[model samples]
Structure formats: C-alpha cells, structure tokens
Target: MQIVSALSEISDRYDALFVDLWGCVHDGVRVIPGANEALRAFRAKGGKVILVTNSPRPRAGVERQMDAFGVARDAWDDIATSGDSARVAMYRGIVGQKVWHLGYAGEEDGGFFTPPNVLDDPLEIARVPLDVAEGVVCTGPPDPSAHPDVMRPELLLAKTRGLKLLCANPDIVVDRGDRREWCAGAIAKLYSEMGGESLYFGKPHPPIYDLARRRLAKLADVPDAAILAIGDGPLTDAAGAMGEDLDLLFISGGLGAEETGTPRLGDPDPEKLAAYLEATGVVPTFVIGSLR
Candidate 1:
C-alpha cells in the first residue's frame, strides 16, 4: 500500500467516499484531529461523503452523538449504521416471529421491534423465551468484557434450540474512550462456530454494504470502482472493502496499530505496515497515518 499524509492527496480520484465513524472520524469521546477538516475539504471539492459506521446505534442516534462531539454537519453528506441495516434485514428475515434480544439492558427500543423508522416495520413481534423464540438479535455487550463467556449460557441455549442469530454490529471491538469493548459480533461468531445459524449485518457482510452503497448512490451516481472506503479496522473496514470490490484507504495508526507495529502517536513504519498487510492478506489502495 502506498503511504500518504492526508486524504487530499488522493481525494480527487473518487466522486464519493465511504468513511468509517469510530476510529477514523473520532475516538469514542472526541473527534480525531483533522478528521472533520479533511472531510469538509473533500466535500468542498465536490465529493459526497457517507459516514458508514459499524456502530450498533442507528444513524440518527449516531448523528446526535457526533453533534455532541462537535462534528460539523458538513463533514458528511449522509450516514448509515449497522443497526439500521440490521433492522431492515431482521424485519425481512423474521417477519411476525418471536425473538429474544441480547444487548445493553436499557436500550430495548433500539431493537428491531421498535425501529426508528416505523414505516419499515414488517412484524408485530412478541417477545419469547430463548428456547421458544424463533430468532435472537444481539446489539452489543453491556460491559467491556462481555463476550463469548459472559453470554455463553444464553447463546448455548439459543444454539441448542436452533434460533438464528442476527448480529447488529459485526465489529468485534470498539474503543469507548480508553477502554475497548466487545460488540455483538463476538457472540454471533462464537455461536456460528458451535454449529448455530448466524447472520451478521455489518461490515464484511454484504447487507450493510448494500445499504451504504445505496446511500452513496443517492448522493452521487458513483460506481463501486470510483468509491474509496476509509477505516482503521483490518477485519471490518479492509475486509468489507475487499468484499465489495472497492479500494481502501487504511488508517495505519488507529485500531490495529499495535498488531501492525505502527506507533499510535507518531508516523507509521512502512516496513512494519507491509508485514502486517502481508500477514493479514488484505491490502488497502492507500495508507495514511491519520485521516488528515
């Protein structure tokens, strides 16, 4: 991958850009340095930017959080989240079926039963026990370490009962301030490994990309070849871009810096980056130390 200093270096090649929210635009609590400015600059030059995120929350909820973080509205032309796509997927897949939800205790309304867009509702779902439920929907963990073991008994019960798992967020982990927390994908992946049916609705999955691509198309009639995907996660961003056949702009000093031997605070080591890309077997079209 060719290393560059800023998005402007290669921004002119694409009519639209699919940018990741968490690691590229902001860490959990605050905006990343120069990220908003870079996005605004890209847009100023007539590029449509879509904030495609693996966040478990819907676009409205994420937009509110971004607004609170002082992220300007002009930084992005549109937004799409894994939660929104998952809701659409679940609505179609589990019409009129009972499902048990596994997620943060207080965020019940965020599930498929009561989506942000009521027009897309396909069912009048009735909650049921794990053994009797037709499916299971996982948004994310309540705690930082909530993963395979934390939800093992429930997941096992669902597995034994043959309930399909709909994972809202395919991201395994994300930074919440200084702590890294496991997302719904961790449980879904474990369930699949144990011979259970699981459908992931986010990155590295076609469904979420389909939604994002539609949104991108609405903003501009850009082909997949002309769209650039920017992100930090190798598993989610890089894998998703490769799966969708889009070029990637990998941010080397973000989430996977340690494994890639790129320092978090300074310039990335090109040799180390090459090794990391070789080992992961996924290469981006370009590499930037930061979104700037």
Candidate 2:
C-alpha cells in the first residue's frame, strides 16, 4: 500500500515504534531528510520509539554515530543493537571458557564486551583445543584478501573442535557511507557452508525482537497493531518485522541498492515495487521513500 496520509494512522494505533537505524533514519554518514521530522511527529503524538540496529559496535559507539548524523538520543526512547544482544548472550554464563573471536580485534572487543574470556588470536584458541574453548563468536566479516584463504582455517578448527558459533550480527552486509561491506553474517554463512552449526542473535531472529519489545514496554504499553517498523533492508527490517507480526514500512533507498534498482528520492513506482516484492516474497505493509 502507499502512504498518502500522515503516518498517524499506524502511529496512533501503536503505543511504541521499533525503528531501524541505517536506512530508515540515516545513511551511514547523514540523516535522511524528513526522517527526523517524522520521528518527532510520532513522538509528539505520544508514541515511544526504540531505534534498533544491527551494528556490531557497542551501544556507546552506536550513539556516537547517531549523534554525528544529528539524531540525538532524546529523539528516541532507547537504542537496541547487535552488540547489546551479544553482551546479553555472553552474560548468560560462559565463564572461564576460551572464545575464538572471528572479527577484527576492535570489533571483537567492542561487540562482545565483558565476556568471560575472549581471544583474538586464532592460534591461541586452537592451542587450547576445541573441547576446552567455550565457543566461537563471529562479530564481523573476515578479510579474505588479508587472510589469503577462502576457507578459513578457523572454521575447520571450530568444526573439528565442535565449537558452538554465535553470530552476533545476522546482517550479511550493510550500506556504509557510499559502499556496501560484509558483516558478521557473511562470516557465519561461510562457517555454515563448511558444515559448522551457528546460533544467530540479531535481526530476523526472534530474540532481538523480544529485546526491543522489552525496551519499548518500559516507555509505554505497546500494542502489536499500532506498532510499525521502518527500515531499508528487507532481510533485517522487513522480514524481521513480518516475522514478529508487526507492520513494516520499507525504505528502498538503503542497503542492497541492486535489489531496489538504484533508489531515488520521493515516492517509488508501485509497479516496480510490486515486481520486486513478488520476486523476494517480502512485501511490506506500506512503502515510502524514507521515514520522512
């Protein structure tokens, strides 16, 4: 469906809103025009908004990024991220266990902060033996060129050691600035292809949504019907909302530009969108250029 009327139709029904960060609110560098206004309007109408993101960085880092883009923390009730989800997973108890971190050292430390034991060197983890190691937490995509190996030895080691792989971010890729780059999900996919088992903890998975809901519940009583999710990517935003039975508003100007066919500003062509949705089987409840 198209959005000709003010978003209040959906906004008024729901007491809280779960908004996606990257595409819907801003690109990696700047806020999308009208998005901030739309969020303000929603808040003025008494709706609580919780900004959710799949960024592998810590919540503080996410906040800094948002601030750089002009989206103040006051604009939203709370922010939920993949890093936060990972922290929750770690805290559930895996103490004194060695973990093989598959992402950059910066990201590993940021995403899985405060873990019982986090080892950046694959050799250190391997030497401990898989049986002694607690699990593998894949935080970001590995650089194949740098590693010079298509099939990472870490994956084989994990498989041989029978390690449990926990994917902190389930997004395969995301739009950053003007380019798309691989995420933790890409590494997780590679591991899975090599017959490794994994547990994903971000979008399109039920646990993240549950976490968002709990965060929203604190601000106001959120009804399933009134809540709406706006996002750029279908896999994480649209699919995740649909999985939770919430209405979704797709922003075509975000990630996977090929899927949206070089999105432009203003309203999208319905005919083109319908074809794309049909091909992907991920139809949104409504469509807009952006949240604005």
Candidate 3:
C-alpha cells in the first residue's frame, strides 16, 4: 500500500470523501486529534465530505452526539447514519407493521428502546410478544459486553418464527472509549446462521453506501471515481469501498492497529500491516498512520 503521512498529500485526487465516524473521526468518547481538521481542510478545497457512520442512531441523533463532542458543523457537507437507512425500512410500512426492537436506549438517549413500551411515541413500532411481532430491529445488545449467548434465546426464538431482522448497524464490534464491545452485527449474524432472514444497513453493505452517494451527489456533482472512502475498519470500511467500487484510504492506527502489532498512534510495522490488509482481501488505495 502507498503510505502517506497526511491527507493533504492526496487531497486533490478526490472531489468527495465518505468518512467513517466511530474509529476514523472519533473513538466514541472524543474526537481524534487532527481528524476533524483534515476533513475541514478537504471541504475548504471545494471537496464535499460526507460523514458516513455505522452508528445505529438517526442522523439527527448522531449530529447531537457530534455536537456534544464539539465537532464543527462545517467540517462536512452532510451526515448519514446506519439508523437513517434502517429508518427508511421502518417508514416503508415496517413501522406500521408489528416489529420488535433489541438494543439499549440509554436513559438519556431517546433513540433506543426495548419491549414493554421502551420506545417513545412515533418510534414505538411494536412491543408485542415475540410471537406477535413481524420483524426485528436490532440496534445492538443492551450492554456493550453482552455476548451472543446472552441473546441467543431471543434470536433463536425469532428465527423459529421466521422473522426478518433489520440490523441498524452491521458492525460486529466497536471501540468504546478504551475497550472493544459487541455490536448488533454479531446478533444479526447469529440470527442468520440460525435460519433467520436478516438485512443489514451499514458499511460493507450496499444500502448505506448508496444513500451516502446520493447525499454526496446532492452536495457536489462528483463521479464515483472521484470519491474516496476513509475508515479504520478493514472488514467494514475496506470491504464496503471495494463493494461500492470506490477508492479506500485505510487508517491503520485506529481500531485495526492491533492487527499491525500496535495500539492506536503507535508506529505500524509495514510488513505486518501489509499481511493484515492482505488477509482482509481489500487493498486500499493508500494507507496512513492517521487521518492527519
């Protein structure tokens, strides 16, 4: 892979960018130093930047969190969250149908819910028993550390009922603060393995990328070849870029740094990093230690 120290070195090559939020821009707790500035600089040069994220919350909700983190509104042209795509399915008659929700809606977070009327009005699709629900909307486990075994019974029950699942986030794991935690993808994977029909709406999946491209095109008349996808997850970001036929800028120092024999910000071993990317089978156009 061609290694670069700064995004500015290759900024002129693309007219638009699809940037991942969780690992590339922030670690769920704080913004990565220089990451936001890199995007701002890209925007300053007339390139459109779309903050595409696997966050299971709606775009507005994700924006609220970004606002709390002090992310400048002008850093990107627009935002698209996995929840936005999943919500599309909901709005397309899914909400009117009896659906079940599986995830933790923090007491302070209004976008999450569970059975027993945990979801608020306009979002409380259906809270009926599993046998009565028509589909499942999995945001993630109720707890970060929740294992598949903890949710196997429920997923298996859904499978037995032949219910379809709308997975808001296709990420199996995410870096929260200083630790890795399970995500909805893990549960969805298990559900599919057990004969359930699960639909994912995030990176590495076509729907979110399609939505992002539409939004990006509205902001700037850019061709597919002129857009670059930047992220830290090899499986999600790199895989998604390849599937979408877009150039990828892999951030090796984020969540996948361990595969390169180091932690975030530590110097990556070139040979090991190459092997890691090869294993993933998605070669990025460039590799950078950080988005800086």
Candidate 4:
C-alpha cells in the first residue's frame, strides 16, 4: 500500500469516487479540514462523487444532517445509503410484515416505517411488539452509549422465535464529533453470534454497493474499473472495497487513528500503519491521514 499526502495524487486515475461520509468527509459534527475542498476539486475536474454511506438514513435525511454539519452542497454529486437499500428489502418482506422497531425514540431514522418508492405494490409493514413480531428491524440501539450486549435477553427471545434481524446500517460504531457510539451493526453482530440470523445491507455487503452503482448509473455510465472507494472503516469501507474489486483510499486517522499513529499534521508512522493494516487484513491501494 502507498501512503499519499493528498487525494490529488491519485484523483486523476478514476472517473468516479465512492466516498464514505461519517469518518472520511466529516467526524459526525463538522466536515473534515480538506474534505470539502478535495471533493469539490474532484467534481470540478469532471469526476463524479458518489457518497456511498452505511448511514441508516435515506439520502434526504443524510442531506439534512450534512446541512446541519455545515457541509457544502457541492461536495457530492449523489448518495446511496444503506437505509434506502434496507428499506427496499424491508418492504419486500425480507424480514416479514410485522416487525419490531429497535432504535432510539426521537432520533431521525427516516421513520423506519416509511416504504421506498422504487418497489411496486410493496409490503405493508407494521411496528408490532416483539412478542408478536415476525422479524426485527434494527437501526441501532435505543441508547448509542450503551453496550450492545445489553440487548442479549431480547435478542435471545427473538432467536428462539427464529426472527431474522434486518440491520439497516452495518457499521459497528461511528464517531459523532468527539464521542464514539455503538451502531446497529454491533447489535446485529451480537445477534448473529447468539445464533440469530441478521441480514445486512450496508458496507462490506453487496446490497448497498449495488444500490450505489445504480445511483451512479443514473448520472453516468462509468465502469467498475473507473471507480475509486475512499473511507476510514477498515472492516466496512476497506473490506467493502476489496469485496467489490475497487481501489481503496483508506483514511487511517478515522477509526484506526491511534493504531496508525497518524499525527494531526502529517502522514501516519509507516511501521505502525503497516502493522495496523496487516492486523486488519486491509490492503488499500492508497492511504491518507485524512481526505486532504
């Protein structure tokens, strides 16, 4: 893997970029220092920027969040979210009709009940109680700060009933500015470990990547070889890129900041970065401390 100082080093190679949002572009609170500039520069040079995210929110919801975070509107051309993909699966009755909603009460989860418009004559899903639920739809835990294993009892009951969990976001955790919180993926991972079946539609999985390609196709006819994937999550973004056979620009400063020993103003320590990459089994084509 080659460690580059900026996106410009390799931006000329790809016609399109599949960029991850949370850790690459923004830290959940604000846009990264060079993210907006780099993306805008890419778009200005006639390159397409598709913000392929594992966010459980639909594109519109992501837009709103981006606006709240002060992210520029011109930074991205389009978005393909895990929420939309999982929403389609949910409406297709992948997890049955009567499902139990497992997420925070007031948070914006795109109403989890709302059906995607792409499907014709979609299934009518209801948020029934867990006792009567045929499946479970998890956006995340009711409490992000709480450990995912805390729901073991509830998951145990659902497992006994043979209920499959439809995981909207396949991210184990995400950083909201400075605070890191557990995500739906963690819960789904735990459920799967307990012998319960958990269905994922996000990164490291093909569903969301398929959705991203369709979204990109709506704008241009770019081939798989002409695309570049950028992100911070080794398991999600890196694994997903490798799975899709795309070149990856892994941001070491996101989840593996300490492990990579990336300083605030320079490239990561080469030895530490190599060790970290070896441990994670992620072979990124390019590595950057941040999107800059």
Q: What TM-score would every model get versus the actual structure?
A: 0.93, 0.85, 0.91, 0.97
Q: Please write out the lDDT profile of model 4 over residues 1-292, one tens digit for every residue.
A: 8999999999999999999999889899888889999999999999999999988887788889899887789999999988889999999999999999988422464555777789889999988999999999998888999999899999999999999999999999998977999999999999999999999999999999998999899989999999999999988999999999999999999988889999753679999999999999999999999998
Off by over 4 Å in 4: 104-110
Alpha-carbon lDDT of model 2: 0.71
Residue 71 lDDT (model 1): 83
What does the lDDT read for residue 192 in candidate 1?
A: 91
List candidate 3 segments past 4 Å from native. 94-96, 105-124
> Candidate 1 — what's its lDDT?
0.81
The candidate, 1 or 2, that scores higher on lDDT is 1
Alpha carbon lDDT of each predicted model: 0.81, 0.71, 0.81, 0.91
Better of 3 and 4 by lDDT: 4
Our model 2 lands, by Cα RMSD against the true structure, at: 4.7
Please identify which of the two predictions, 2 or 4, would achieve the higher lDDT against the true structure. Answer: 4
- Candidate 1: tens digits of C-alpha lDDT, residues 189-260: 888988888888789888778888888877778888889999988889999999899999998878877766
Superior by TM-score: candidate 1 or candidate 4: 4
TM-score for predicted model 4 compared with the true structure: 0.97
The runs of at least 3 residues in candidate 1 whose Cα sits more than 4 Å from the true structure, single-residue gaps closed, are 105-112, 116-121
Each candidate structure's count of clashing pairs: 0, 3, 0, 0
Q: Write the per-residue lDDT of candidate 3 for residues 205-283, one digit (tens) a residue.
A: 9989888988987777889999999998877898999889999899888877878764565556898888888887868
